[model samples]
Target: MTTYSTGGEAVVEALKTHGLTTVFGLPGVQNDWLYNAFYDARDRFRVIHTRHEQGAGYMALGHTLATGKPSVCNVVPGPGALNAGAALATAYGLNAKMLFLTGQIPQKMIGREMGTLHEVPDQPGTLRSLTKHYDRITHPAEAGAKIAAAVRAMNTGRPRPAALEVPMDVLQQRAPIPAQAPVSEPEEEPVDAEGIDRAVSVLAGARRPMIFVANGAQDVPEEVTRLAELLQAPVVGYRTGRGIVDSRHPLSCFLPEARPLWDETDVIIALGASARSALQGWGKGGRSLIRIDVDNTVHGRYGQPEVAITGRLESHLPLFIAELEKKGIRGEDLAEVMPAIHADWKERSSVLDQQIRYLAVIREALGEDGIFVDELTQIGFASRILLPVHRPRTFLSTGYMGTLGYGFPTALGAKVAKPDTRVLSVTGDGGFMFAATELATAVQHGIGLVTVLFNNSQYGNVQQMQRDLYGGKVIATDLQNPDFERFVTSFGAHYGRASSPEELAPRLEEAFESGLPAVVEVVVGDMISVDRFR
Candidate 1:
């Protein structure tokens, strides 16, 4: 079947064929036709109009992070794209599967620099640098193939953001689009049998081994757990990899607990994650390292590993387990040692009592399968190593980007993706205000997200650093915050206040039960810094 369609309509049709109907974006004149296409297909799509372009981008990120599926975000070119730049950078950093669509100036206005509406000097260059794949749609006929190609690109290799720019005039142009064809994903590269045998040889002979996981291993939790149990090696996760192995699993360990074990281990199996921090911080002397990742670049990121397998974890892990089984290898059981290590880490981490207390309360309110979006705050810092994650994708972080003010908007997106699952955003005074206006977006769209605002009346982290490093002299760290009660209520959201963790428990419960956009303000003074741990 063939149909005459505008470029915008063609793009929508292509995306729909690819099973993407939810779009997060703020409409503008440059992309008016795209919005029109969206409106016509309203019954087939869920259009989330956000307060800002960044909110749209972040929400798209949250959707993908929670579901491990590709997400879409659309914005106008120039200012709109620039507004969403931070989120795009963060997406790139986290290797998120996101499709970024934007409207360019008129088709003939390319590189003319006439000060036209939403014109940027080098929009294409900027986008290409930010995403793994980028292209432009010049006519309606090109929309389907280009959109399909973009979707395919993000899904393949190391999953990252992809971009497509359609000029305003092109969006209005009409052309014949053929029936959408299935967008076939690229085939996984053959697993390296030689690499797998070498890795297994090292694993099979090791008395003590450690398994480190990151986002790459997120999908193969069972395989990772099976391997860990078979080897009796503790599975350690930090940041994005935290919940790959359940915390209740005897083999599960956090970075803090794994430090001592790192020195004792004879071999390390790094899956879908680079143990970069461990090598840089703890030193990797007297240890043979095996790195398995889809991206070959990661194989030599820090230094060459003893064995590097460049293929999907889904492919390589099973091969490794099968090869080890053939060898009948069994590793030392550290079931008893893990508990002792965790207890020691607990006593050592008591300096972060306040953050831990608040995290515990929020965890209680979130129940078993809820998601927690973290910010670049004191509590957020503690969460990286201290929080107990029971399931994969339950914990969301900004990864290496360390983005501030991403918590609230990201949580809103998570709630949008999984409406039945409770989602909580933890932010501090400074970071919360960055995308604070999104509270309106949440309330208006009926996104029930429980945000725990830690109000310290300042940039707590910077102030603490200033005091500790610069002899108590602080500048511009103190904030004159609005009455949070009024601020939240003004947006027609439920508001609760707490002075301590005990008070926060009931407030969190109330916020979750309300089933509305809610904010729980937890007031605190100067907090103990978790910077040293990092």
Candidate 2:
């Protein structure tokens, strides 16, 4: 710990209370006081420096998601926070829990005539818009209570995220330490028996049912599987819940297929999910939506439920299963609906399999220890179609906030976070290029990640629409290749491009075997063409 001062001690104490092991971000003058605080507490805490603030925020996010616990990030204000805004937005968008810490210029000099040095007008105000909870420490004396409020907020009603900002001067002052722990994490309400019965009644009554989950509920696949078995509902994750269960599971009907689903379905239950519009199926007047989530913010108006139960997913689900069994809602038979859905999906899967054999070959060659990272484009759908994600934590994707450029940085973080695993970034050409510059960060940092850039060249999703609706005329759907493999070589990361499935498989094999940073570019054509195109 390179820190000092009573305020600094307060921050350290707060982190210790939270059991935070690592802090990701570079030390800067603005954050000097906080760094000094860390220096002082170095024996109990450790800091992991990142090259970019975005990377640091993302690294902390990856750590939080992987470990299922909150992670800490220390960033300087201005560009540091701005650069990290995307990751913060992602955290909010994903319902991920984290603490974003930033050091401020002295509070007295906040908005003065001399331009406040590195201060950018409204610092905490700017952050407050994106975060669920954020506040600045006005005085050293208020540190304990403020930090406790932030921590308590993280455990309460709806945990988007919390931010605690301390000014340089504020961090240097001596403050009274609280004797007792500030805030305790809130406990979930036990799954109510009445609520369970109500949920099952709705499910049992529905002729056509669909379960759209948003979070990675698959961590307890058996429980989820049990529920699905009881209802015989077609299970699918709108976006975040993509790989909750094996997409290839015979019982589940949804994948990242392009065509519309849930159209014929009359009932939808959203559990531990952020019930977005896309998944809800707009204008479906008759479809009833049943939601169960720990976060109360998911429901509108107030923390009320619409045929819902509120609590942690892990704890509540088993009880739900027990209740369903107790009520004698034994088995469901959607035999007719199941066959048609299966046939429609199978037809599409067969067509897709013919084209993307490369993804499977690559997975096989990389072996069981391989780790897969997915981007938002067809890379996500394609991987779902081509690869078999057999185990948990072996695969990671932005299920909540599916964004581009998330792949490379997240892969690097995952690699560094779990060095023993073989990490692979499966992303579209456009998405891959978003953080392509980070290849230098990867190589320079000496982290080895195998990047499989799905080179459809243009924004694959947009091109597919144009190809289907228009006459396949290449409008904005074209790219000037920069010899990606060689282009990234300057960054000390190896590259290999493949135009065919045969070519991609061998290249991925060699790259994974090398135990170094490498890129394998695969031209899979417009995979969406498979989605919309006959």
Candidate 3:
């Protein structure tokens, strides 16, 4: 049976087939047909209208991160596409699966440069640089297949963002609507026997073996935990690696405590994580490294690994854990060592009275199940070590991209995805202003998001850099912030202020309990600077 449909209708059907029930986008003239298609099927699809294209992209990313599924973000051609670049790049850096759909000029006038509205000389090429895969729909009939291909690319192997562009005329044209079905991800590659043997041998021989888990291994929490328990290895998580293991576990250690152990440990098992700067080039010199990753290109990029297992952690970790048990290798429990390490960190962290106090309040306020979205702030950098995350995907950040202005929008998306769960966006004064307009989006949708704005009136990170490196000669870092109370209230949301550390907890508690979109601004002075984890 054949059915006639416009390219826009085909896209809507494809999204439904892909199990996408919600999408984030802003309707515009160039993409009116697609919006019309969505309007016709509004009962079946929930479209979140964002204030900006960047917000739409971040919302898609937040939804995907929370649910472990891909979502769509639709934007007009050229400028809107460019505006979405930051969130798309952040998604790429975080290895998130997102489908970015954009409107393109009519196929007939695509490259003629006849001043068509919303035209870019090479739109697809620009998007190619930002996404894992890029495709353009030239005809209405191709929409379903191209969308399927994009979804496949998003789900297979190491997931990343993918983009598709549809021309205006093509979206309006009628063609046969192909039947679509759910796209299945490719099977995880079988664990290599030789690599497993090599890894097991190293673990068995080493007296002190440490496990370094990264965000890539987030899916295999059980396997990761079992492997750690079998070896009794101290596990260090960085970036997305947080909450892979319970922070309160006896063997769980953060980067600060694990840094010294890097020198003492005879063998290091690097799982689904890179030996990046955050690890301080751990695998470089004297340490023996056994690395397991889905991307083989990372092998030997930082340092040569004794065994490079090229397979998903979910597939290879269980095999390695079983082999370790077969060889009668068991790790010594670090029950005593872990407590002392945690105590020392606590004492040192206490020295930064204001920062630690603020973090403690927020941590207590959010409780165990609450989600924390961090932007690039002094508090954000500190929270990576101080905050305790207990579940996968609970802590969302810009990751390696270190993108500012990511917290609020991403938190909005997370709230949309997990409406029942408490979600908070923690940002600095400078970063908060970037996406502050999102308050309208939240209030309009009745998303009761609590934003904790740490207002120091400066780009604290860069200001500290100049002060330390250039003898206190600060340049363009100071900021004049708006009256947050008035700003948020204007959106019909509540607002509160805390000038000192003692006031934060109560204000945060009140704001969160209000069940409205709110901002709690904390005014910390220049004395609150970034402190290194010693």
Candidate 4:
């Protein structure tokens, strides 16, 4: 056999086997090996050029979140790897299963103390403190297996980002092994019958049973909804479980205000919830708690466990529901609460309804099954309250990282991943333009991702915060723009504009059905937040 492939080739081959088709990266001197690997492997995956290394890292993370696949990003050693720190940290909180491949200065030259060109005194050790896993390969041939192992760890277990460092020389050297199949996540691991029975016992006896679902609930979204129905539990989603239960649903009460929670609160049933990790430890001291994911290592807020079920969320939740049913612990048939919940939802919907003249028309025109992936802050305000997406994953918002500028690119990526989904990105004017170039990519891919620009003419959140905390003089926050819809349309795409409620509906409808990468700019009124959520 010819000995041509090197360590870098092995890593690229492993990534291809895992089904990654596109990788974002910036090349540098120390990364010549992987850079060459990327070019040679161009047939399997395309390299997306990024202006900034950090942007490339986040783009990969965003792709992972949108597709539920490990996205790869290549970075050279030292500053290049350091540039990815912030983005990696954000994805870490979001539970990103991304594979970040970086190159290291050759091992021999690393510590010559010559203060080499790309010297990072202790790159792996430094990054290890910030990341979930960081693997450095000293051998060329083992690159495939080691990289696969890192990906396996990242995809399963706690589900976070993993990094690998390939030495420049080794990447050019011949590898001893060939690429292999990645280790697959197990078929299933159900919730323990004993734990579920115990949890059911607690809920059945309680006069007031409340359910608090967190970001982790998305793993078993159907089970989450079913459990809420089974228990007549007033369902509330944590910041991460935004799309699991329809915000429009009477049971999804964690919106605008924490009213449903304060009224008649008693036992809080947490399924796939991490009190500490989810940052919901507050207000739980007085309330009794029953947690499903019993992995204490998952969070610091692991309180005195009343009931702990150890299993995968998809399996555990179903088993938990089965056990509850067997225990004859039927959810309280509080039709009375349903009516109250419905009344509350109707009132909130009406408030949103009043504000819909500007957006509702466009939303309707887009059609019911239209997919809306939201930016972090805007989506929280608009989509959850305005857009009205009832499907899980259809409304992709930041549950953990809450990163901005994720709007444009993520919509582009999601549209590509789920080609059948009618993808739209609803974004603030400032946020939309951040990764606006992805528009070209979307067009190139032939995916018509509709873009809605919330033209508040400023960094709305910061300006709003200023108004809330300070006297709202609006310093350095407002952003200037040119009929951005026109700007995008000039790039050979459909576009529209709406400044008043009268124009919003018609323009939105027209734009959605137009069938191209379109943008509709909506100039929002100075409507101070009509409602707030904790």
Query: Best-fitting candidate, measured by TM-score?
Result: 1
Q: Pairs clashing in candidate 1?
A: none
Query: Residue 501 lDDT in model 4?
Result: 64
lDDT of 2 by residue, 444-479 (tens): 667788888877677877777777778786587676
Query: What TM-score, to 2 decimals, does candidate 1 have?
Result: 0.98
Q: How far is candidate 4 from the true structure (C-alpha RMSD, Å)?
A: 3.4
For all candidates in order, the CA lDDT equals: 0.90, 0.70, 0.84, 0.69
Query: Which prediction has more favorable lDDT, 1 or 4?
Result: 1
**Candidate no. 4 TM-score:** 0.87
lDDT of 1 by residue, 88-169 (tens): 9999998999999998999888899999998999999999999999999998988889988998898888999999999999
Q: How well is each residue in 115-176 modelled by candidate 4, as lDDT tens digits?
A: 88888778878778666887888987777678778877776666778888888888888856
lDDT of 1: 0.90
lDDT of 4: 0.69
Error of 2 at 233 (Å): 2.0
